[model samples]
Target: MEDAYTHKDLAALCSVSETTIKSYRRKFPGFIPVLTRGKPIRFRKEAGEVCLKIRDCFEKGMSVNETLAELGKHFTPRTGAAPSPSPSPARSQQVVSPEYLDKFFETAGKMMQGMAALATAQAKAGQRLEKVEAVLDKLLEIEARNGERFNELLTKVGSPSPDIPPTASSSGDGAPSRETVRARKIVNVRGSEGEVRSYALEKEADKATGGLEQPPGSLLSTPIVIRNDQDEFLGVPGRLPLSGFVEILVREAEEDGASLSRWERAGEAWVFVMDLTGGGSHALYFTATTTPRGNQVALLERLDVDGKETTPQFLQEFFRQVKDKV
Candidate 1:
């Protein structure tokens, strides 16, 4: 006769904590046969195999929902064997043969190797596709704005004030604009090879000042502000006194349940890889400094997933918040 196992047994078989097993059970209700849900929850003998499958999917980096879906594809209910005399305790202890164990390990190894190769190929293809799309979109935008941009340049050139010489540092209105003079070039680096991400900055009318546009956080005083893909705020980014604002971001992410997978200093800037608890990961590059010029934290790219996601759309709101705080 087969022996049913308790939650503790299943946890041990799956090599996961009891709490993790409970979470999986909640996610995949009815997948496991629960004999009882009292003080010590028990499961049918067949639930052991299901637990193993769950563990495999998680180890392969599949999300909880994805794991459940994948397992559901090949799930089969257990059927009891024909009635027979119970085996001796010593005989029952010998479950798997050496040949079977060796075969299982060999197959698992091949599957993992194939999966790694496939994942690498897919990631590279996706990154290349994203870069191409970004470049095409930028070209189309520049083509569309050629007329208006040319007119603006002509206006700036034609209407220069005779009293105030039109130097490179001075704005067209004869005022020295901080944006034009203090703006720094930020390069977006991405992909496994980590090539420099480059694209044209299209002309946009500033809604706040009703004039020329500025960088994402140019008008704000805070070190950084974060927002989701839908332009919703995800709380303000961390700030430090002198330097190491990047360290503050890492600490804040840990506090918020995000795992810091990769972090490294790149020249004068920094790159961070964060794995969100909700699933998916993001690569962020930024530069923060309190220099003789001023305090500035510049985000190089709009936080994007698959090339298009949450952009830094809260610049106006950030400026408003800083003004209110002051």
Candidate 2:
């Protein structure tokens, strides 16, 4: 009787993991013949040689198709037992070999096991898919409810309040006065250090105005005033090309002893990475959008200091200096 080797024996011989040997058997099923199909299945002794050859081929970076071609040169692939010749009429009484019957039953059992495993996997996959779909449906329902509530709130905000009496200036024309318009109270403001406080906005405003109150009629008469406090950083002209503006900023930063590490286009924005002389880094993202006049304007969308999302005071000063040169 020919000796056969188990998966472990072959794995030890090849200096490879047992899992790797199993994978090889699965990948080149024809090359590795099973001598006995049972617990710790046994393969023909020649299978070890085939496994070593496969390992060598893999180490050489040969593709599966290339390995298959190479394997065909030295080994005869097992294509299963040839069909028995038809019994001659003169000698019709032929006894079936017990060994052949055993082999037949083992192969059939393997097939049945494979089919059972496949059915189990498919059932588990279907259950997981149903769970995912249920979660998505719930999320969509929540999103729809939130959208409806938001719209209702917007409508309430835009409409004039019936509780407040109409002023003399608005009573004759039946139009809402400026005071009648909803003023969105500042609920919270987040600072550069990520601290959130309700008084932060007022405190910052006081600091900017040196705690002085604006005299009546001295302020702008417009309903809304878009302040240009950081005009040096944000006062880019609409007519200027965004690329040219970026180049100017880069030159200014370089002249200030800061070196640009790299720059790249991220979607519709240009990202600039810079290395500061004080052993730190910063990234600035500049995005361009078309105005109603069909002119492009560049806006600084985001700033990062040393890979963290923060707006340090030094960065503000740096940009102010850059702006002077621009």
Candidate 3:
């Protein structure tokens, strides 16, 4: 009977890791015949020599196809038949010809040189990609700064100019002008519903008066409450006109002692970095857009904490507080 070797035994005999031995068995299945398919899988003694031969070919810069061809010249591939008895260790050792050793070493040295060059090329490519990534990050930062500046400009433009006098055209009695009186009348017309009705009423007033009325006060002073189709209070509207229903999350965050920094503006969304009291930080993206029903609302578009995306559930309490406060 031929000597049988477990994977570990074969690994020791071939001076390779057990993982490498298993890889050889997988890559050259026909050449490494299993004597027992059970646990601690045992292979024919010849599998050890085959592993060594495959390793030598690989080290000698031969591709799998080339190694298979070379193997065919040295040993008959197993055909799933019972393996014939292999020669004793001494006899097998003597079978390795001197010409094979010389050829193996010569090819392996060339392969090593080629592998070193490939590694150097890969390192250079990796460095180039890192540089490109850095540039993109810088560009994104610049874009965000620009957007923030643009937002500031828009806010400034929306404000009442100190240089311009009131255009109410007051009557001699110092009473409000006819247009102002008409605009105020339009504003006072209340909808059956509470705040939501007022928002609609104000829009009508704006259209009727040709925007002569001063831009409404800060959201903090005159917070307009909105609701969804389900009649749930969505929160107070923000002053960002372009965004339909912008919420005043910044005010809420600031009240909680969270330091906030404005980041980039992505589309209609403004990204902010909020640093909490616990020394943790989060990326909060607030998207301002008009609802299909023509309501302006700010939404918490996305939230990221410590570089990981998370559900807004973390801020549910904070949001609840904002709603209650409003």
Candidate 4:
């Protein structure tokens, strides 16, 4: 039987807080497999192997986004849930028991193993399969410290198999690809009443205090570009698209005398608490989501800061200074 572990085991192995693991689970949905769900979540032993890699990436100074991208190479989600092997006539009549569940899981593991083998065969012969083998080996570990937890969590949630979609980097040797980090376009924005303001992103040199540059597109800030209703070039939403913007926002908040109480990757967004200037604290959200227009948009919001809602003017000023010195 493949080994199973709890959140505590993964945290201790990765030298990260349990909260951090939960954040990883939320942010990178398809990356790790949850053997059991609900409170006090349990993970497959393979999770620990992946966590170890994540820890190494962080220790090497790679950001959360970068770490996930790196992990994409070795970990590939199965197309569908693992299929159960054919049962014998007598076995079919027998009542399902713990041993039967273990056998079923074993079959699923073999399915994964077959897929991995096929991947190896597709790769160039004599290629260094160190990383791939290591991940598979760790996944096949027989430690079952939390079998009961798995039984319960899986009982509540139908199947144990994950249904995450595969990424471009999940196949082959996992070479770095521009497709993995493509810049998402944010063409235009529509207000509450469908009032639209169209805009385009243009690259420009980062200037000190220069207002607008020619071509009406160059923002002269970070690689990201966005404009307001008045066609005034605003700074990048956060700094870069996705989590990169979150990192910049965190740095800016800290530099602006906001003490960071906590930060975590929340679902498709990054949520963090900032004790702002003048002895007040607020929750800051850096969210990236796909717009209805098929473009990705990065949004920054301050929630209930000092008992005051974030105003439109405040957002405008915030965007203008998002990349003040950068």
Candidate 5:
């Protein structure tokens, strides 16, 4: 059985605005409050609700850090798997009851509505900002005209008048606008001893040395974006396949301090290796993140060795030998 509370009561307990509560619910589908005809609404009294909120935040593109901050908690040390005693009896009394849960869902519904409302509000604000900016420009132009006329009138009347003040110090009209600048990291993985990233984009027709042509069936190079925990794009790279034995030039070294791990299958077991090039010359760490992807992909991961597994250090050396010839 559930004890129910009204929308207002739940809002007070959650320490969030009714509007905010509604927004939170909108992110997660199918959130409902238990309600009764004559009594208040009821809500679940478990941390499960909070957990779901965290998941929803992640799906909505919020980072783990953002999720923690939203729930008003700090990082706690993890404990080994073991049962712990329940909270003190007095503390349990303060926990949210089912009645409060009902209210929480109600607020959650409103929050979803509010999020929709907020999107609408943001669009409206953008329009309003543009309008205000336009109006301000017009007003400033009018002021300019009025000042000219006033000064002329004063001179004709043989009266002394003060000069009009220039535009406000706070005015942004003449100031340069700013935007976030993102640095582009490009890795030039040109095979053999050659120019940076192959000046083969066709535009450098005049300056590029074409004495060296790529051997047939060589790497058809392309780039992939490296993304951060925040989903912000960090670098563009062309990862050389170990099969091709091509050397990789890691550009923008500072941005690439973190190593990248790769997984592949060899025979029955799956193998993994990480690019530890930045760590040292011919250095790599190997581990398994999962089992092999069957014989089909395993053929691709096989090496000239026992056709078993491979480490990143071997890969770097294999490609280095290729570069040494040219």
Candidate 6:
């Protein structure tokens, strides 16, 4: 769990910037933790707990943007709610009716205005956003932490019964074969919509094995030549047959590179996020999560493309169709 979610990890998971997180900590209390006052890491258990609640609140009715907007409404005291309190009450009271009342009030008012301006300014910074993001990250971190403990217990349970060889999905090789097929026509398995057949592996990348990993697919950014059956260059996603391809690459992809989604073997199928930047359209990229149940796993996901939704049933069929064709 923690292994998969470092600062870089959470950034990728939450789709935000790390620097933004650091900035948030400076503004919001414990938004990001610096336990020993060193470099920051995920908030610990307490903050994590709050995050879950905040996120639940957000997901059920608000988006990050919406949550921030709501938070911003609380960003400052309302009109007449509290005029700027002086840094010190004794000094502040003196200003209320002293010789310097008018001057002091004016000066203090300016100072308060300056500070308020500063606080508001900080809030708008990406770092301020990070503070809010940290709240959300907290939930993931908690779940991740629990997942770690569960895995530990499972590992402690030791290998499966000798009679039961753990039946698990195959791992990937992270390599590309020359036989990579150009847009082999794919037809969507969904009952709705038009043909969406996926191009299967033109040739066997490698033979199947119980524990053998398949070569990981090229990263999402790795450009692929999408051609027609005649092998004519059809420049991804434009013109006839909608031929074109763009690989989605996780910024942290390995040397050979694969999307974070496909870097690990989840279950029966390796996954990748949708390369939805125009050319990468058509080939579905996967995002969402999967739950492991004994030897099998099931994903909770939607298509990576904008304005497209997919059911888990469709996802399973799509992967199967790809695997079978490949």
Q: Number of the top candidate by lDDT?
A: 2
Task: Tell me the TM-score of each prediction against the true structure.
Answer: 0.23, 0.25, 0.25, 0.26, 0.15, 0.19
Pairs of residues at least 3 apart in sequence or in different chains that clash in candidate 3 = 238-246, 244-296, 244-297, 245-296, 245-297, 245-298, 246-297, 246-298
Question: For residues 1-326, what per-residue lDDT tens digits would candidate 1 score against the true structure?
Answer: 14677777888888888888887677666677777677677787778888888889989998665676676666753344222223455654467777898999999999999999999999999999999988966864464356445444434433323344333366778877543432222223466886766422233332222344322222122245343467443333343221233444456567778643454455655544567677776555555433233424343333434234444554344323433432
Candidate 4 lDDT at 207 equals: 27
Residue-level lDDT of model 2, residues 1-326, one tens digit each, is: 24898988889989999999999977776788889888879999898899999999999998666677678777888876222233454443335666888999999999999999999999999999999988966864565456555444433323333444333346567874443333232344579999986521111122212323321111111011111355433443332344454556567667767743566566765566778776787777665443343323456656788888655465556555545654
- Stretches > 4 Å off in candidate 4: 1-239, 264-270, 276-278, 301-304
Order the numbered candidates by lDDT, best leading: 2, 3, 4, 1, 5, 6
Candidate 3 Cα outliers beyond 4 Å, as residue runs? 1-233, 237-260, 315-317
lDDT of 3 by residue, 98-124 (tens): 799999999999999999999999999
lDDT (C-alpha) at residue 91 in model 2: 46
TM-score, candidate number 6? 0.19
Question: What is the lDDT for 261 in model 3?
Answer: 39
Whole-model Cα lDDT of every candidate shown, in order? 0.54, 0.60, 0.59, 0.55, 0.39, 0.38
- Using alpha carbons, what is the TM-score of model 3? 0.25
Clashing pairs in 1: 229-310
Query: In candidate 6, how many Å is residue 178 off?
Result: 11
Q: How much is the lDDT of residue 235 in candidate 6? A: 25
